[model samples]
Target chain A: MSEEHAVPAARLRTRGLHLAYGDASIIEDMNLCFPDAQVTAIVGPNGCGKSTLLAGLARLHAPRGGAVLLDGKDIHRLPTREVARRVALLPQDTQAPEGMTVSELIRFGRQPHQGWLRQWSDEDRDIVAHALAVADLQQLAQRSLDSMSGGQRQRAWIAMAIAQQTPLLLLDEPTSALDLGHQLEVFELIRRQAHTGTTVIMVVHDLASACRFADNLVAMHAGRVIAQGPPDRIITPELIRELYGVECTLLADPVTGTPILAGVRRA
Target chain B: MTNAGSTRAGLGVTFCGAGIALAIVCLASLLIGAGNTGADLALATLLGQSSNEEARFVVYELRLPRMLMGLAAGAALGVAGALLQAVTRNPLAEPGLLGVSAGSGLAVAIAIALGSSATTLRISVAQLGALAGCLCVLAAARTRGVGSDPIRLVLAGAAFSGLLFALTSLLLLLDQRTADEIRFWLVGSIAGRSMDQVTAILPSMALAAVLILLVIRSLAALALGERTAVGLGHRPELVRLTVVVAVALLVGATTAVAGPIAFIGLVVPFAARALAGSDIRRALWLCLPLGPLTVIGADILSRVVVQPSELPLGVLTAMLGAPVLVAVVRANRLPSL
Candidate 1:
């Protein structure tokens, strides 16, 4: 996206990142960079630490070994609010108080920019309106999120991240609980945002969908990246077999010219 | 579950209507007192057909101050309850249940046992104790994963309150005279209170007002949960700190003035949430008016129901507040915050 926009890119780099829970190490010396304005999908099996890697990037999880640097400074060194302003993260499972409207949930995306004195501003209003419209949530804004269908609620949550207006937004399994249509709806929203120059990093289980939607894919296995690059290069059958421990054939999606996983039986 | 919007409006209008009813009860209050100086002569004096000196003393001097204290005490409990419930995001989270009042009560009991004859000083001590209790509970709630379980927090609160209350009872038992002095007060009644206690508590009440204003925004953010609250740039620690201080001050002041009234906080906030929807800010805002209304109204009920002898305000509040608590627990099934 930055290559097309011609704006100078600020790299998000994780150098020698190590994470552990008590005694067990989850990630070890993981050095990687999320290229600016690119939709990078971290794909792996359950407990492979793709979500953990995403959490480190969003500053939600503190690193045990090295630094997650946005530009040159360590993200942990920044104030939580400042990191929030620059990097917005949507955790896989988010909840709101009962009776909260869709609009109210999305408006919280403006949290980083809002303070007591500057509670209501024209800029905030515009951003909230735009987010709702972009997510096709305007008609449902006034409706209570708990009362809505799962797909509608997911869209509302996505709308909230969109409203944050940060260049770098990370989503952890945004499509985890959705049906096929709902997953496509969420994926399309991610794709559209990426097209508009926002850096969307998501953890996805579906490699085919990631290949179709993500501009770049970082395939992982056992807390390490197996490959990182464009889907056509990274989604090869050899890489897929290594990442998932399954044998599968990969071919071009005739429609989008993206890598398509044609057949899959567990190895 | 009750629709918080229409429920609040209904309660507001009902509580307001009850306020008018409270005025009539206040007149009944003016008509009677513990003073031996009054009888039917006070009634004629109040009606303006007669002005017996003894009747005037009974009505103006004795009954008026007691009536005023009841109103203030009830309002304080109600507001404190509403604040606790909103801030904690637990409908069952009343200050009394959380040991905030017991903390205050324990301090006053200790003060009484210490041979402190100074009433004004005991007020401050009670407030300090309430603040300590609030801090302990908040710390417990925020540490790591403990805050995640709402029911566990409520249970912790109940245990904390029971411990403090038990300690207070022990302190009272150590000194017979102090025990006699504190027994009715501990049970919570506005009987025999002087205007001096009311004057002593006004400033803390004012401070509580200001503190509530400052944290209302953060509490609203908190309703979205902690990470979201941090994401909004409002420090969750600061918000919790401010709320604890405000609740402590309010609970302390009411304890000082009324001697540890229970259930007004639980019921008032419960009712307010039923009316104002789930927005913490909106609930807090509505609680201001609703708190005093519920308290004063309850006080009036305490007066008329017993008629000749009169019941303790705390007893009535407990009776009303407990059923509301049962309803709240049953209403959500999941015990929603």
Candidate 2:
């Protein structure tokens, strides 16, 4: 409970961020500040630019205009390695190189902290150990990623990001490929990590799960943010209908009191 | 249980094992040639027990330079293959299949046809041609469908290689003396190449080695995927361009001295990955010893396989490497980068 209220007010802001691929602009004039140390879920229909916005925030895609600010400093102005030290991103569909063990994969997270003469150190070892513990993957540290189940592999990837020790983490549909049980496992882990003071932003397809797991929600349609607030405040029937072009019942989950969507139909 | 520390330590052991094997092969290369001098006489000559002038000449002048050439060429091809594979993120990507060495061979043929005999000049021209060829195959691979599908990229490379080989053959037909001087070279051999030829490619090799060191970590990050690599603070485009330049230098240097030795580039890196795992960083290090081991071993076998004359090193390597190439393709799950 003490850690729950201990969220640091580290700020990540975007000012009129614009993202494009060739001539097609995906996200245009985006302006927002991520809730510090809270799990923020960006939910949207297919190709609504949620993922593009995530990539822009993580500095994976250069913005066509404006800028992303980490702690009020323009992210683009910082050296790439310096930015990596502050932000870690887990893109969907990452494939570990053949025969890479979980621990070996996690070691790559330390790259920004290391150089030719500083390949590894006591701090790196400690951080990797802590990451494995946090992900509950200590037993699987030596196991090859190929030998793991989907849930286990997903956890391993998250552990790599955690080992990066960045204050901000961005995941693009991290649980997209998992089974229901595995998805819950990943979501719970993500929640627990966010509770520990790392600001988490994820692109989520499941609006119900977003409501259940995220503290703040950003709903988008057609490359623009349509609503942003607590999930309970923002996830209304009208919002659901507008985002998904579907009619649905909006009710609270009896167990958690978060909004839930049911009886969906094409609008 | 193999943790991060154990894996790093494991790579060190693999490197040492490959080094030992390389040393043994280098000794064998020095000892067992087609010359009348027996292994015992060669060993005696090596130990300075008997100062036979013929034995000294054969061992020091003849066998030694060939051994050095094989070592350098093997390492170059091995590292070049690893770098190319990583840049493409396709385990099957190789310079030989992708027309790099063929391009170098064609450049050398053109140089000879144009009446340029300066050994240093030939190496530079070959390197420039190799850079062009590497860039060409990479561009073809990047075209929409070919980038994701490994086999299609190889097909594109093979088609490009065929075109280059055809052009080289046309050059062979264009002139007789140039053809005579370049024919054996086109087939690829480590035989009778002077130490000067080995020395001539040194700067290029050193340049390649330096570039590889600079980019190894970024290349490893790249195996995770481009966006992931970029997120790790690496400039994927810059890393890829640097790797292409390094591959060009190494392959160009190898082709200039050994004459387009096929499959060494394919086989050496493949074997290194098998031993050292797929981290391009670790695999590149293991390639150092494994490359020389493969080339020197093949060179030794080449001398004995055809007694009076000798098999071309390229032919021997191709004979050994073709099966490996087939096996890599036939593997149920191609190792995804």
Candidate 3:
């Protein structure tokens, strides 16, 4: 638990955001607000525009009409480096150069904060160390990324985002390829990050895990937000059916008292 | 902390070792040549102990200029290869292999065919042609399915290079005077090129060096993938464009001087990465010295192997580089960047 410099959590929202790929419109007139310092998961069926929305929020995609706002200002209006200092993104399917170590990958997080004359400083080094510790990757810092397991590799990437030291972090399918144990490992780490007053927004594929882990769940259907609220208030059979065309029984987890989908199948 | 420190030390040692080797190779280049002047005489003349005018002329006027040309061209080609490979995120994205050299060669051949004899004008024409070649290969790579497959990109470049080579040969055939003037130059040699020609390319090389420094960090971020590089606040498009221009300047200037020397760009950077891992920053540092070392060493061997009649520098590099290219292709996996 190294003492990271205290920064105010950033508020992110979309104001009638319209996203498209060339001539095809994906998300049209979408309005949403991401609560500060919370784990918010955007869950939807495939091609429902959840990932596209995340990319828009991360400023990786430009809006076809409207804009994404950070705090009180339009994100697109700010300098790219300034936005990077406030928001960090972990893109899906990242491939680092072969033989790059965990520490080496994490050091790149400091690039936005660095300049030609001022490359490595004490602060950069400290932040990288803290990120490694936060991701539980301190022991594996020197190991090449290609030599690591999938779980460790994922953690290494997450550690890089953490090293960026941004108040808002956006991840696309953070746990899509992980096994149950690895998923839990990553989710728990995300929870810890959110608890530290960093805003965490992720696009998740699993409804069960999304309901279990997210403080707030946003369900999308056909390029629109179908339902959104705390998992307990929003995890209904009807919502489940609308999302996946599947019917599922809901149960309460005894330990955490969160909603859990059971006996799921197509309707 | 200790591991990182040790790795940094290792890189420093490698850099120093390469520098020393480059110096030795440079000295060898100055001493050895296809002439009556022997190494002992050259050494004596260098030490100012001998007044032999033939040794002085051979060492100072001929071999010195040739070595300088080798050093500059070698470094430019090596850096160009490293930059292209890093930007493309493909190990096979070599300037020579990807037709950049051939593009410049074709441009020079066309200029010579049109009776353009000015070396300065030739350098600019060569650079413009190299830029066009770079854009063509990269544009082809970016089309639909080719970008994802590194081999396909190389194949396209090979095809493009073959077409350019055919065009150059056609030009040579149409003009016998052009053929007589360019026959030896087209084979790629540093022999008999004057000091003025080497100095002509220095400004462009210096410019390329500065551009490389400005984008080195961004280029490393680029290796993490495009989206990631963008998220890191780097303009991937800008970084890529800068790299292409830098590659054009380096490869173009070198090709203008050395007549399309192949494989120094491929082999030098390949060896640099093998020694320094895949980080372009470290690999680039190694490339600086290794480029000169490889070129000058090959140049020395070319001079000594066939006595009285020297081999073309391009032929020697091609003979040495083709095996490396084959090894890269035959590897278990094409180590991405």
The model with the greatest lDDT is 3
lDDT of 2 by residue, A1-267 (tens): 112344446589788999999999998898877878899999999999999999889888889998999988889888999999889999997987878889988988999999988878999999999999999999999899989999999999899899888989999999999999999999998998998899999999998899999988889899998998788877788988889899999888999898887888899
Task: Kindly list the per-residue Cα lDDT of model 3 for residues B279-309, writing each as its tens digit.
Answer: 8999999899999899889999999889989
**How many pairs of residues collide in each model?**
5, 0, 0
DockQ, per-model, please? 0.38, 0.60, 0.56
lDDT of 1 by residue, B142-221 (tens): 65564666667778888999899889888777889998988878878776677787778888888988998777777777
Residues A1-267, model 3: lDDT tens digits: 011243324389898999999999999998788878889999999999999999999888999888899987888888888898999999997998878899999999998899877879999999999999999998899999999888899999999999999999999999999999999988888898888999999999998889888988889999999887788887789988998999889999888888888898889
Of candidate 3 chain A, the 10-residue stretch with the lowest lDDT total is A1-10
Give the CA lDDT, 0 to 100, for residue B291 in model 1: 67
> In candidate 2, how many Å is residue B249 off?
0.8
Candidate 1's C-alpha runs over 4 A off are A1-8, B1-76, B139-152
lDDT (CA) per prediction: 0.77, 0.88, 0.89
lDDT value, residue A157 of candidate 3: 94
Q: Give model 1 RMSD, 1 decimal.
A: 4.1
Poorly placed runs, candidate 3 (over 4 Å): A1-10, B1-6
**TM-score of predicted chain B versus true chain B for each candidate:** 0.86, 0.97, 0.97
**Regarding DockQ, does 1 or 3 come out ahead?**
3
What is candidate 3's CAPRI-style docking category based on DockQ?
Answer: medium
